[model samples]
Target: MSATMEPRIQYAKTSDGVSIAYATLGEGRPIVFSPRVFGDIHLYTNVDYRPPYIGPLVERGWRVIFYDGRGTGSSQRDATGGDLNRRILDLEAVVEAVGSDRFALCGVASGGPAAIVYSVQRPERVSHLVLVNTFAHGAEYFESIPSVRVSRDLRHIAEDQWEFYTLALANALNAFSDTETARRLAATIRAGVSPRAWIAQRDALEQIDVVDTLRSIAVPTLVVHDRADTIGDFSMLASKLASRIPSARFVATDDFARAADEFMREGEAPPTKEEQLPSGTAIILFADIADSTALTEHLGDAAFRTKARELDSALRAAIREDAGTAIEGKLLGDGVLAVFASARQAIEAALSCGRAGDEAGLPLPARCWCGRPCGRWRALRQACGLRTVAIRR
Candidate 1:
């Protein structure tokens, strides 16, 4: 099945009444993906789209679960304050919702610490544990890296100077140079929670210390780290974690996603050409100028063609920004057709196209519709030519 298929968003309430938002994709052995504090289930699933880490697993028939913790994304706000211990309940709620007796667990970035604690406490429930770009102890991580300390100190500025703080945090997160990615990361962070809540989440994350419990985890484990990660010194952290956990395997590479793929594939031959292309389910988007005929009549063919080219460029860029793949085909003479990993992403891309077109002075307006049908390239081709944009799952 296609890894880009739109996952149904669902809510799971924690013991404390905080609602956690989660989504599941594919069908097979369940793998719970523990997200970082700023990670949004909807946005990250769309942003990374076919994420290198999870896509291969999904393609191999593993069901992937993604959830947003309290005070972030579609989850409930943290009116009760941030508690590191309570974070475990978020995982528990998601696991319960998935109705799985045992499953593999993958944690990324800040989500690693919680995953470690959960695996240690509930060893029977977690069949395998994978941690990427994370630390066992947050305090040690900050102390080990001076830049991290400086980043933590910047949280004090988040509430008063959110824009500046977002830029600084994005830089600290190693996103400053990639302007588009940085902007999107900033938007995800902003959409997740208020500036004050960001501070609380950071503080809670900093307080995490699971070093004492590392040895207690009995499940098979893999620790992957990027040697050149600017965000954290994973070289030291990965080695320390691997040495502490009994029978744990440690891998050091520049690409966390590739490391994950290797760990999952385990010496299997590379996938063939047919296996490379996505199949099964996907979300498709089609967009065009709302009144192209009238605009063309008024502006004449030459001017209208120029405007059409500009609109197409703007729309393509927007779709790419949202990690949507724009299909190469003619749609209503001057429209755009794209496929996203998620319906939420398709909607976001359509909205982004409208904004981009407006900014570029193109008379393009976009709308979105979603549905689910089963077919392949021919169906997608037929749908792409529609005057109105529609998303089929």
Candidate 2:
């Protein structure tokens, strides 16, 4: 027999004639995780599970229960018909079938809606509610603004360009697995479900809306939103829900996807640049594109001009907010600067700017530098200690 250590997989039949697939691991209070079937949970375990909020929860005696929604994973393929009501019941059935009553629920993305609905229908079965990067209403989720809508037309990619779709899914999950691991998971997802099944799920998710029912959720709720999340603006959506729900708490985290992508390659060498200072100190940080001219070309003159102005304003605000004084300089066609503060603060500011650009839907360029401020920085070398570099606007 071929050796296997995969998370134990099992299936349960739902009332609506659908077989649900789930995997259970670790030990403690049952914390049921109803994840959006972007792919198999096993595939994203290493990549997606590495988040600080999750890994710790599991380690601290929480039996995390993860399952595939309808039309996903090892679940029955014929059970996928694009219905939110059915999906909600599927979630309830999974929890009940698994023998975990009064369990904690953590839902992400589309799963958030599912969890909310399930919680409403079976309020007595839930303990604590943790919603991360999720939305209450489908329309409001995608339509962050009144006029704008997030793209859901994956048919072209799902049909002819299948691999790209898998890769994109992997990318969204920040697939940190090695080439072999990624390939195996991607193949498994593609093999497990038909394109029609995915289509049904996608369409069902788009048609979902439950903004009105959010107030009825009486469970203790924790909402975590990524400042740089491209999916939906949970900041506004969470605020709306939190206001209605009396005991809800809202917390903001850095971009989980980006952070996942950055830390994925476990044994791989981290990108770092180090230099030595005259005082025998060293500085290290990763640096690359602050402003790529191609982004300007792509954004067009009008949008790019407006984006530049916004970028300038954000930068100025950051500077004014005790991040660090911008020791203004120019790098290529973009502006450059130096900071005399702690290395961590500079790195944080850079990441913050990147997040802001992404939120504004503007393609901002970026470069990071960290290490010993040695001969590489003439001003640091000349000053022998912290020294201000030339300022330019």
Candidate 3:
């Protein structure tokens, strides 16, 4: 499938009469994507610059669903007082609108709690649940992660310095320092909602506490996390989240794309032992801090070491958050290496590293550079020729 193929946008009305915006892409088993806070379906589905993560799934022949939450994106902005119930109602509205009796739900970031609530409430409708870089309790996230608490000051930034906040947020979410991507994301954020709605959504996100409700989920669930994520430690957050649900499977990867693909492909019979390995095209992404020698000289040994650890944590976190797998590569002092399922995923993950580093207020802010190399994997044969191109910002 070509990356330029556009998805048709449509609307679904909630029980309260608020219109929710949505779009359908590709073909096959329907998978409804629960939007991150402030997500806009149109921005996400734009053929010119759609998120790299969604493309692979669509190309693999899945009918992917995208939607804007109430008060954000192309959805009804007048519904500014949306709460948890209203959020659930929005999902319900979208599901009903899509007319899918049984489908999969993939929750990204803040969308996780809402997906969890809906899965439990409508178990019969949800065939599978996938949560990525998400937390069970909103309060726990703010209280446990100091950086998250500091980032909450983003509300003030969003309200007072709207443009700066969006750039910062885009950088933080993407975890890289690509100005072009940041600017694009900034426009998307601005087009998605007003400052007031952004604050309202953040307020609603903070109130989410679905820990007590996890056990009630009856659908097959997959919880994925990257241990190096800067938002929250996987051991501290996502692991506990997976543990709460009965029979939930926990898979850890450096990136979210491959794990997500695995989750979406669930219920299909596994390949035989002889056919277990994968072949064909794979994209490898590598990221590392730039100007480490100068940075170390400026910050000194002790401080530089601390900063390196922080950068490592932030980059790893960003990779996982972006759904790319982190490959253990030779440490080049101030840089790290990871592998991604697609060039887009790798690029996005690298960009997110810069954004995450900025949001964490690291002493030595990191800028990530990515390279894409294509290669084929033969089950038991050595690899052949490979070509790589570097993308730096």
Query: 208, model 3: CA deviation in Å?
Result: 1.2
Best by lDDT: 1
Ranking by TM-score: 3, 1, 2
Give the alpha carbon lDDT tens digit for every residue of 18-53 in model 1: 898998876887889887776447454553212344
Candidate 2's displacement at residue 144, Å, is 3.4
Q: Output the better candidate (1/2) by TM-score.
A: 1
The clash number for model 3 is: 25
Q: Once model 1 is optimally superposed onto the true structure by TM-score, how far is the C-alpha of residue 273 displaced, in angstroms?
A: 12
> Taking the tens digit of each residue's C-alpha lDDT, what string does model 3 give over 68-145?
888887888888855688888889999999999999898877778889999998899998999877888888877666
Candidate 3 Cα errors over 4 Å, as ranges: 46-49, 144-151, 174-176, 226-235, 270-393
Model 1 regions lying over 4 Å from their true place: 1-4, 45-52, 78-80, 145-147, 227-232, 254-393
Of 2 and 3, the candidate ahead on TM-score is 3
